[model samples]
Target chain A: MEFLNASVIPYFNYWIYVVLMMIGLHAMITKNNLIKKLIGMSIFQTAIILFYVSIGVKTGSTIPILEHHHDEGHAETAHAVAESGDHHAEETDHEKSDHGNNEHAIEADHGIDPDHFANPLPHVLMLTAIVVGVSTLGVALAISQSIYKDFGSLEENEILAKIKQGGPGVDV
Target chain B: MIVPFDIIILIFLVITALISLRVRDLLGATMILGVYSFLICLLWAEMGAVDVAFTEAAVGAGVSTVFMIATIYHTRRHSSD
Candidate 1:
């Protein structure tokens, strides 16, 4: 069918991400062990990070750093051309060149396509998310350890049973 | 082009995820989860997310697995559910 055609190849990476995400979600929902649930959560977080990083990819593009030498060369050439021109013809040519240079300056200022660099925004944000995930995992593990000390088991059912029976130190 | 490599890595990822979930022993599952993290880290590096790949390697594969192992040391490894 149309969905099986060649056009779908470009988006195959997204399909893979979705599939991985769903697998992690299923594990998180159905898994009974606390550690298994944490593993599923980690898988889910990685999948989302993959999705964000994929969005910033551009074929044949380099990193997001300005090529100062290239820009300097272009500036010298533009200046040279501006200096060696007749008055009337120079006016028209200068106007066109000025417009082009202004557009390029704006693009460079915004880091939109400075020397074909990839977007750096997602990389920054995902860095924060990764740290947050680690901290959350640490806190959850600490709580799980406490649960084990108090209830003597990691299984959800056993923990629930202990709570239902009004075991000592089971106020929460 | 790059699609073939992506597909192969994705297949491995899916396999590791399923295995991690299917394993009965919590310790075994933790090890498999470590493998899953490693594979995804490679995939991220391949996709040009070097920063993310580095973090996943350190946090997901290294620290998290160690934390799980330590927790297992404190508690039982078998799952009754």
Candidate 2:
């Protein structure tokens, strides 16, 4: 009860993701069909990606587009913040309440609070992961098609049995 | 983010994931998987991962579903277990 009340409420996102990951793993392990296995693999991959993306979530923080102030004090604040790194740490939450304020061009990171923006690194990395997952799905599906063509079945046990038979067409 | 909204979407996501895996027809499962991907993308977008959501919508939900369907057309759709 204490665990549910205290820990689970705050971190329910992580908990649900863990449940999803387990579901994917179970499907991957117990499913018999080749396409089902691939679907499970995709589920597992997406769950992992979602977990990583959730890591970057900061409560009340806007998207990580640091809108430059473009005022006279901008350069001064940038230089001053660079000199005193500890100050920017405390003000990230209050300063970053807006999202569509990207009129100005790119500026130095010293002026804004780092915590004001959700971490971009994880999202970026997951983009690559998504690409790899899609490519892997395509290739694995193609290979499964080939497997079906060879053995005339997509069930794992049947494929194994056919391979064990060592027929003339059993190149696999 | 709104906590209740996030919770709702996450719950829906888990349900969709489970259904997709449990469905016997490969094509139906793939379609449910696409629904799962779209839910995740919506979650990402609401949580401020816009670019990540965009990519997921494009790759995970759109192209991957088509890929699975194309493969299904060539292979068998029913699963024994």
Candidate 3:
């Protein structure tokens, strides 16, 4: 079927990703509050994540888990075997039934059903981004908290006011 | 055959973005921003980017909006006095 064909152009996703990236950048630059800035940062980072994941996606792809189910009637297993087109599937299926704990070598190595192979790089990048985003959030929140403590308010204007006033005991 | 839904979704996404920028009330503007994300998510799904839609729906609509509102609550709710 043409629906399953991989020839369809991917245009809308690219536009959405670009728009979202711009929106996040606008928010980060325009917003004044520290927390809002962090939110903007998260939005910016998440936009890139969306972009990566979208670019990596292929139609009819499934979760990259190697289903260890050894039941002979499993359609997913049959599909995987049929798609992989190698004796490795039979080996996996046969080995999985007799020695359930021996799937590490088979599952980890190769023959991952070409039609269903997902680009895992995006997922890996997103995992890194999640960590980086949280770290940034933590630092921003700490700075906001410190600014609040020093100026008695969190507003950027309030902080600026204290700085402009040359108030004692308040460090800019 | 190409679906006309793409044009419709793109138009809606642009409209929400414009509305988000034009709105006066900060609260309303933030709400429109959420709608903007939703529309963009739809656009991603249309382009066969389900993973992108998933991230946008979760982070943009869900987390980003919450943080925006929370920041608003902590700061001034109204625009410049």
Candidate 4:
């Protein structure tokens, strides 16, 4: 019960994806029509996308864009470090150039906080997936159209029957 | 853990999916599938995946539905099974 409350309850969105995936799977398996199967495939694909997107969500967080205020904070810290380094440079004038380079690196590091931004890796990957899915759907629809043109039906068994008879339409 | 709005949207998604599968009319199934995609789009946006939601709305709801409808127009809309 403790594990359920801690782990399972917090990830309710994943449960929604699981249910959706099962429904899509059932449709893909049981449906006879090609178009229906395509619909099922789309649903399945979207469910998987949802699952991935949900994994990236953080509570009370905004989008991945770094705000101007964070940038200002980084600049202020960098400026303070440079001021302190200038005092040290009076004691050791040889390292002044190196300290300037280090200041730039520190500023870059402080410019963004990982926890403040949503995970962008998943978003980039899913964008490719969405394009691929659209292309696959297009090709599948084209094939189904050709099958209908040749076999005169989109039902799998009917197409098989037509193929078994070695109909003239099968040649095309 | 449970957001009432998300739960409501998920329920609608499940209902649309079931209806799409069970409906005998191919066109009706396609339309229901469009509805399913739109709902998922909203859900993803709510989950802070605006990029994914945008893509899904365009591909799943917009182009895919149009392609399926065009294919249905070319092919037989009724399944003989």
Candidate 5:
């Protein structure tokens, strides 16, 4: 009960992914059809992708994209910085104002809080993985079709049985 | 982000995976696997991975299903498992 409340309830996302991965593994191992194995492989890859994406989730955070200051624009910010430098040239108390500017810069650095946005690194990585999984699935299915043409069946046991008979590859 | 919604989708995801793997017809299994991909893609979008979700929707569900179906067209339809 303690473990359930502490671990299972809070991290149910991970537990579900674990179960999904096991289902894929069982299908890959016990299923006799080549297409079924390929399906299992797809499921397995998806589970891992889901796991990574979930890890990057931050509660109460927005999407990773930062809001653009489109209205003000880059040129406006640059203009402001240039105006501040002009004040340094003519100001009688430049030293005092420079000390205040340093404090403002420190505050600006502190404004970059990570909790406001979701983690994007895992998502980018998983995008590549999703592409790779589809390509691998396509290649494996092509191979399965080729094997079916050569052996006349897609069942692994049947193919093995035919191979044991001194083979279709040998005579046919 | 909503707790109940996540739970519902996850339950559906597991159900889809099992159905896809256990179905005898390779074509039906392929379709169910597409559903599996669609659900996971939804999960990603909800989790704020919009780009990943878009790619998964296009590649995993759309293109891969077409590739599988095209192969099945030339090969045997029923898988003897």
Candidate 6:
């Protein structure tokens, strides 16, 4: 809690994540070897995923679980406070309730309304990315294996050489 | 808090990148790259991107490392030198 009072620093972490993402992407783009490039691509993609998940986190907030029965007492007190207050206070509490309802709607649309707490969008997207990455890896490995078997070497140059030497009919 | 944590993560990331580049042994480089992914994952979590961190932790640190090492074994293990 003490550190929370310090200057706004939460945004700095995101900046570093972006920088790392760019560096990894640069490597993926410039690297020559196929496998090295794939590694770079993984790094690049992962940096962004990290960025997405981090955005959903809220300080001091636990997982969004509704304590409906427990919250009843608190809500009753809040209602009492509103009833005793002047019109402005009553209007303010009404506004707060509306805002809460709006948030609940958004959470429902996303189908991740777990106590109205975490942002579920990022989790859903990450799940998709994980599946896609694995599929891509499988395909890449299959291709690499086929290349090695055909050329008797993994280097791109060696494969080209074997292809040239065979004059186009030799298949490994 | 964010500033210092970010700076530290950045330094580790740079070191990992340099090592991955300068190291001649591909296997060693791939291992270092795995470490790089892990550090970056922490950075992401710090940024409030829990979902992203989860994926990075799983795919980047777990699957990708295995993929790289398996490829290296298939290609380079057979080589005598």
* Residue A62 local lDDT, model 2: 63
In the range A5-103, model 1's lDDT, one tens digit per residue, is 655567766777788789889878887788777777877877787787777655654443334544445433223223223222423434534123222
lDDT of 2 by residue, A47-82 (tens): 899888888787886676546644445433223334
What is the two-chain DockQ of model 1?
0.51
Candidate 4's error at A101, in angstroms? 25
- Residue B32's lDDT in candidate 1: 92
Q: Which of candidates 4 and 6 is the stronger one according to TM-score?
A: 4
Against the hidden reference, what TM-scores do the models get? Answer: 0.76, 0.82, 0.55, 0.77, 0.81, 0.63
lDDT of 4 at B18: 84
User: Model 4, range A1-172, lDDT digits (tens) per residue?
Assistant: 9987787667767877898888888778877888888878887887788777776666654454444644346423224344434534444434534322233232345554444444544665787888888889999999999988888889998888888888875553
Candidate structures ordered by TM-score, highest first? 2, 5, 4, 1, 6, 3
Alpha-carbon lDDT, every model: 0.71, 0.80, 0.57, 0.73, 0.79, 0.60
Comparing 3 and 4 on DockQ, the stronger one: 4
Using lDDT as the yardstick, the better of models 1 and 6 is 1
Tens-place lDDT per residue, model 3, A34-152, is 55455456556656766675655556655444455444444343244343344344444454332232233333445344335344445555656655665666557666666766786
State residue A110's C-alpha deviation in candidate 3, in Å. 8.9
Candidate 6 lDDT, tens digit per residue, A1-172? Answer: 5565453355544665677677778766765455665666665665666565555545443333333533345422123223223333323334545223233342333343423344444545676776687678767876887776766676566667778777458665
Model 6: residues with Cα > 4 Å off, grouped in runs: A1-14, A57-118, A165-172, B1-3, B47-55, B77-81
**In lDDT terms, which candidate is top?**
2
Clashing pairs in 2: none
**Model 3 residue A73 distance off true place after TM-score fit, in angstroms:** 13
Off by over 4 Å in 1: A6-8, A62-116, A169-172
Q: DockQ numbers for every candidate?
A: 0.51, 0.82, 0.20, 0.54, 0.72, 0.28
Residue B53 of model 5, lDDT score: 91
After best superposition, candidate 6 residue B14: deviation in angstroms?
4.0
Model 3, position A137, has a per-residue lDDT of: 61
